[model samples]
Target: MKAVLFANTDWYLYNFRRSLAMSLLRAGYDVLLISPDGPYGPRLRELGLRWEPLPMERRSLNVLRESALLLHLVRMLRREQPDVVHGFTIKCAVYGSLAAKMAGIPARINAVAGMGYVFTSDQLKARLLRPVVRGLLKLALGGEQGRLILQNSDDVKLFRQAALVEPAHIRLIRGSGVDCGKFAGNSPRKNREGATRILLASRMLWDKGIGEYIAALRLLRNRGYTVQAMLAGTPDPGNPAAIPEQTLREWVDEGTVTWLGHVDDMNALLASVDIVVLPSYREGLPRTLVEAAACALPLITTDVPGCREVVADGVDGLLVPVRSVEPLAQAMRQLLDDPALARRLGEAARTKARNYFDERIVIERTLGVYAELCGPGQEARQRRYG
Candidate 1:
């Protein structure tokens, strides 16, 4: 079987879904990865995976360019004629499905990671585009050959409520999946003398609650709590909500946060930090929190959709109100003050990661989807799902 994995950026494919690609190869599928050109394309090729670049502008609204891109996809699909086309994220999912349909592909898998900028942003532009995007989604996600993969139940609910796709066609897959073996072996903090290090690992975006995190850090400082605020990952230039590099530099200079730009080795970084925090407004089951959980690090994240999916309140980790500074600060303070509580939470988190968020489980589930949809002469099964 041949599978084509498509995404908006090469970096996303390299970092987030590399394990899934490798699993496909192991299963004797000819895997081809497609994304816009970037440094990571060569890295993927180095992994013995076939990677091709397709032109896509993340922030483009030009209809002519978008139409041309769709045409290009249609031509490529007709040429490659893969058994299954699996697309990650919103734009890729829609375009890949549309093109796959046009090219008469056997199966399509559209992974909607989150309710992205078009649905989440309160900006006028986003608001204006929402209905149009919804219409496109309805068109793209229809029919028996295509299946929609949602990361969290909340997204599943939202999609159902909006009547975007058939309930039977939607599948809940927790995340891209974390590598437990690789991210494991973080010991709980004990007898630490210096400032408590709180790390937030994500792209620097306003919607990610970077402002609230900074505000919470300031609140901690004002309360005379000595702590080190660290940020991993750089601003995403493609995202409209991305915080600028200059602003990040300014925060670093003023001692508000120590910004570690675009960290490749997250395991080492997670091991160094005492606590992991992601006050994101929303997510598609954040890889950072799951990776931290795999490393047995206590977490603090928002109570919103995807964030809540990983951390049960006061169970695996703490959950604070979204976009709130005081509650976030309070949660951080609590974790920092009580070592025993933190240790208990971290231990539980690791257990949860092994049970639910392991990459092996995800790969099995995903491959099952492909087999169900693309298996030779499964007419009865297709009818049941359809």
Candidate 2:
């Protein structure tokens, strides 16, 4: 069977969905990836799978452009005529699912990695646009062949209560499973001679708790904590909630946090850090926390859906309320002040990640979903592919 996966950008497919794609390939399915071109376009071609570039504007709200893109996608779906069409990210989930349905695709899977800013906001834009967004989702996933995959229960509950999706069609899968082996365990924690390094890896956005993190850092600095904060990720100018470059630079100049900019080596950076932090307002399942756990680095994250699922309160890491610097700082201090506690938490995190967040488990569960949707022929295809 041929499976065509559609998402916003090629980089997202490379970083997050590569495992799932490879899993599909190994299971004997013809895998085709559709997304806008990125640096990873060559890499995806090298993987021996078909990569189709479909121009998509990641941040544009232009209705005409979006409609044109949707028509283009519909044309592609009709031409490809895959057995199943899998959609990722918010835009793809809505538009791609609709196009696939229109093209008479047999099966469609809409993976809601996170609810994202649309569900989390009450701003003018959200208030004006939410009903349309929710309605589109309903139209896309209303049928029998549609399956809605959620990464966190909170999002599932919200969507169900809001009547955006039927409860019966929803399936919960834990965050894109972490590669425990790739993010190996860390050694025993040793006291930092003078400076303690804290790392935050996320797209620089206001809603991602960037402001709160900076406030917490300032508070810590005033309190004379031997700490230095480093941020790794590009500032997304397209996102409405993105942090301004000038503001980020001001913080850097003020010694609030060191902007490492975009770094390719997250594993190495996590290894070097004393503690990992993600103060994001919300998430589907934060890859940063999973990577941190795999690296045996204790985390300081918000008590939101995806973040809470991974960190068991005081077990593997600490959880603070969303957008609250006081609680964030307190959690950070707890880990920094007592090295023993941090080490204990980190060790526990590694164990939990290995047991629950293994990539193999995710692949198996996803394949099972495909089997349930497509029925017996999937096994035959798997055998043939093997």
Candidate 3:
């Protein structure tokens, strides 16, 4: 069998789904990666996987351009003729599913990581596009040959409530998965120097609660706390909620937070930090928190959909109200002042990571999704539906 995985950026395919691709290859299935060209494309190729660049603009709204891109995908799919086509994220999922159907592909899988900007943002453009995107999702996501994968229960509920896809077709997979072996370690890095280091590693987007994190840190500083806060990851220009480069620079200049832009070595970075936090307004299950969990680091994240999935309040991590700076600061202070509590939470988090978010478990489940469409059961499904 041949599997084609598509995402908006090569970086996503490289960092997030490389293990899945390798697993498919080991299983004797041909795998081809599709994404917008980037530096990571060569890195993916270096891994002995086949990769093809597609003309995809993540934030583009031009109807002509989008139509042309759809045509291009259809043509490519016709030529490649893969047994299964799996698309990740919003745009890729919609377009890949439509193109796959147009090209008469046998199996289609669309992974909606999150509702994304259209549902998350309150801007006028986003507000207007919400209904239109929903319509497109409803149309493109249907059919016996297709399966829709949602990361969290909230998303599954939302999609079911909206009737975007058949309830029976929706699959709940937590995340892309983390390599627990790579992240888990016996010797976690300790801050020998004073000051509790709190790290939030994710794309620097306002929707991610970056502003709130900074404000909370400021509040901590005002209260005479020696907490060192670090922001790892760069601004995503393609995202509507992306923080401006100047804004990040100003924050760094003001010493509100240390900006470690685009960290390549997350394990090393996680080791150095004392606590991990991602106050994202929402997520499809942020990998940063999972990695932190594997590293046995205490976590602080908002009580939102994907964030809550990785944390149980007062169990594995601290949960704060969304977009509230004071409550966020209180959580940070509680963790900072209580070393025993932090250690206890960190231990529980690692246990959760090993049990749920490990890569092997996720990869196997994803392959099982493919099996629903490509395995011998597919023939029976076709006969029953026909």
For model 1, residues 1-386, the per-residue Cα lDDT tens digits are 89999999999999988999999999999999999999999999999999999988988899999998999999998989888899998999889999998887748899999989998899999999999999999998888778899999999999999988989989999998888999766766677779888999888899999999999999999999988889988878888899999998989999999998888888788888889999998999999999999988899999999999999999999999988999999999999788889999999999999999999998889888888787867566545643
Best by lDDT: 3
Ranking by lDDT: 3, 1, 2
**Residue 218 displacement in candidate 2 (angstroms):** 0.4
Stretches of model 3 off by over 4 angstroms after superposition: 186-191, 377-386
TM-scores vs. true structure, each candidate? 0.97, 0.95, 0.98
Candidates' C-alpha lDDT: 0.90, 0.84, 0.91
Q: For candidate 1, what is the lDDT? A: 0.90
Residue 48 of model 2 has an lDDT of: 82
Q: Model 1, which residues run further than 4 Å from truth?
A: 378-386
lDDT for 115 (candidate 3)? 86
